[model samples]
Target: MQRFVHGFLLLPRCSLLALGGALDALDAANATLGHAQHSSLCLSLDGRPVRCSTGTKVQVDHGLADAPELQSLFILADLPLPDAARDGHARQLHPWLQERARYGMLLGGIGSGAAVLAQAGLLDGHRATLAWAQVPQLGDSHPAVLWSSRVYEIDRQRLSCGAGTASLDLLIAWLGRLHGERLAQALVGHFGLDRLRGADERQPSPVQARIGTGGAKLAEAVALMEANLGEPLPTEEIARLAGVSRRQLERLFKQHLDALPSRYYAELRLMRARRLLQQTGQSILQIGLACGFASGSHFSSAYRSRFGHTPREARSQRALAWRDEPDQPPSADSGRTESPP
Candidate 1:
């Protein structure tokens, strides 16, 4: 029987949900095939255990330098791109990854892993998708990459997907290509998924689902609010765009979201600002301005009230957490290896 090996390059602070979802899909595919048609190996930059964003430690089998030949490799990183501008190790990993790609291995990323690939210059001229929260920053940082809001994308040898269950979608599609549509269908059904979403399917924004189809006007207002994050539209203006009176808009929000329209809009803008703060290298002032705050102080105050921490505090905590991460060197290559039979 033909066999393939797929590598997962797990980064520090990767999303456990995304990693598990992708692995589960592959496991299902293998079970459906009744053999190890698709074998998987977890690797780190250095062959060591890496802690995920949720504090789960995963012991990897190989380091990048010692990785066995593989059909495809996925970079899995869920957090911010580890401030590559300041970290020398991060800088080095890029070229190392580029060399792997040059060797004709199918390169892919999960969640913010696309950000890492973009930083490595591997995603240039490639259409890719990332977690929705990271989309704006990745677009700004890597204009050469054709970034999409879709759940996942497969462009040539490059594959990418948003975080969480979207990883299942990406892997299932890949499994379909490798085995057959019949096995893929069986795997999806086994996972209890209602249906497999196509690559072209866009991820619905948070507000879109919160408002639901019953509240078309509310959804429209939310969409308008999202579009006007930089320059917030007045509630009256949002109501007008949604073809409803301000009172009706207010009623809809209170009924569905349990919040007033103005409050919901403010929260939305604040949430956008928080994501930019966490995901982008943008300055607090710039993020504040981008999120419709008049000044840094105003933004900080609002952010503190909403998130219970100042923007500087949030950023400082992230930096501290990164600094506290242990740097494990690559393990010496052991003769023991798992290859397809």
Candidate 2:
């Protein structure tokens, strides 16, 4: 059997959780097979220590220019993506990544790394995903990449996922394609995973899940409300479309969400406005109108009532909260494992 090699390109403030999960999955697979069928190394833009999202420092085995023999390379990119063309570090990586892709090395991105790959023109015209709405700006033009909101995406040689634990699932799916289903099943059993998520599965939404569990009436009503948030439908019309009376719809919302139907609907719109405020560069009025509020004053009062802060304050605090989380220690492994650097 041929020994396969893999690599992870660690960017500054990369998610240690994503990296650790990917590494642990591979290590578990090797252990389950009772032999070392694969190996992995870490790479950085420079041959220096890189800081992970959790502030843990990792020592890479090599820099981009000195990559090792590898079957695949996975990138770990930051969200609110740093401008690759202008950022000095990203500029150093752009050409190096393009060179690797030209040779058909099965380039993949973990989480927002897909955005970084797109910036390098590596994922253009391909189905890729990042959990963010941010796109890389390339020479006043955006990449022609088909973005998906799925938990993971595997299009031919380009693999990507929302990362977190999803990276383990992506690896298993790719490995099953590479090796065999038998080994893949064994890996799953070794890890005791309840079920493997498919690549096409959409990322779960807490708001949607409120109605997604049970009760068809609640589901249809919430779905209609979500779809028509811009110009919200009347409670009566929503109830009629949901195959329930107005009173029945109100009761369902109360039972499931502990809020009246109108209150729940208003909260949903407000929550969406909150996300837009944090994620986009839109003006407060624009976001308010998009989420169905009629005027700036109305939106501000409702938002303050719900979140206890003004939209401007929320925008200023929009940096990713997980960036400051502490890195976790490596999981114990039966096979050879790399210690947290």
Candidate 3:
């Protein structure tokens, strides 16, 4: 049996928890197997120890250029991706990652690592999710990738998950798929997990904290805005539905969110419009109407004012840049069950 070689491509300020979880899971799985069938390595851009999220330095086994051919590789980064990873460093990563994909490598991303892959154009047309907070920004940017709010997504050979323990779930689930459920179950016991989570589960909403403290009336008004985004309700009607006067609504928003009710509401509509423009193949005019803009010019001006780009440019810029690679690996390596070593 071929040894299952896994590579972890670590970025600066990478999530220590995420990287540790995946490494420990692999270690435990190897221990349970009583064989060295599974192996892991850490890669860095320059083959040096990386200062991770908590300032702990993680040593690397290889630089990107010298990385050994592996069965799988995962890019792990911290949430709210730091600027350094996406700048000149990412330009170096893109072509190397593209080459790996060309030869049947299984790629995964944890936390904002998914964004890295999307930036490299590797996740285009592939369903993927990152930490939920990163989704909107990703929708506006790498709209070619089918971004989701789910805790994890496995589209064909590509794997991805939200930050933190979600990375554990992704690796463990993939372990089960590659080996057997018995091995996966043993690791769950080893780690004392509640239960193995599934692909459909969504990460906890990051907005819960704000909503909890924004007061009931404010939350109600926001809920109404969210539900009526396509056909937005007037602030007066929203206030009335929330059992508050329009004056009180304005006060509540200003107090908690620092934006007027109408301004907040318009921003929401525009955000939805931007997502539709980037994430879907919708016509610009149709998207404008759907997002409550009455005219193309109004939509264009609003979109440019908010996102600093027109809807056409937003769609055109994203131009399926990742489609250069074949969507699936050859049959020789794809979906073939490995004989246990």
Worst 10 residues of 2 by lDDT: 332-341
lDDT of 2 by residue, 1-341 (tens): 97878999988777888898888878888887789997889997655788888889999998665666678889986765654434445556766677767788788898778867877888877888765333212211333887776778899889988757778888888887877888778778877898778877866555456666677678778768866777889999999899999998888888888988899889888978876776566788988888899999999999989999987778767644545545543323212222211
- Give the candidate number with the greatest TM-score: 1
lDDT of 3 at 266: 90
Question: Global lDDT of each model?
Answer: 0.82, 0.76, 0.80
Clashing pairs in 3: none
Model 3 TM: 0.66
Q: Estimate each model's TM-score.
A: 0.76, 0.69, 0.66
Model 3 / residue 160 / CA error / Å: 0.6
lDDT preference between candidates 2 and 3, better one: 3
lDDT of 1 by residue, 119-171 (tens): 88888899999887667566756889999889999988899998888899999
Give the clashing pairs for model 2: none
Q: Write the per-residue lDDT of candidate 3 for residues 239-299, one digit (tens) a residue.
A: 9999999999999889888999999989888888866765556789978887778899999
Model 1's number of clashes is 0
TM-score of 1: 0.76
Badly placed stretches (over 4 Å) of model 1 are 83-89, 204-217, 231-245, 274-280, 283-285, 292-341
Best by lDDT: 1
Better of 2 and 3 by TM-score: 2
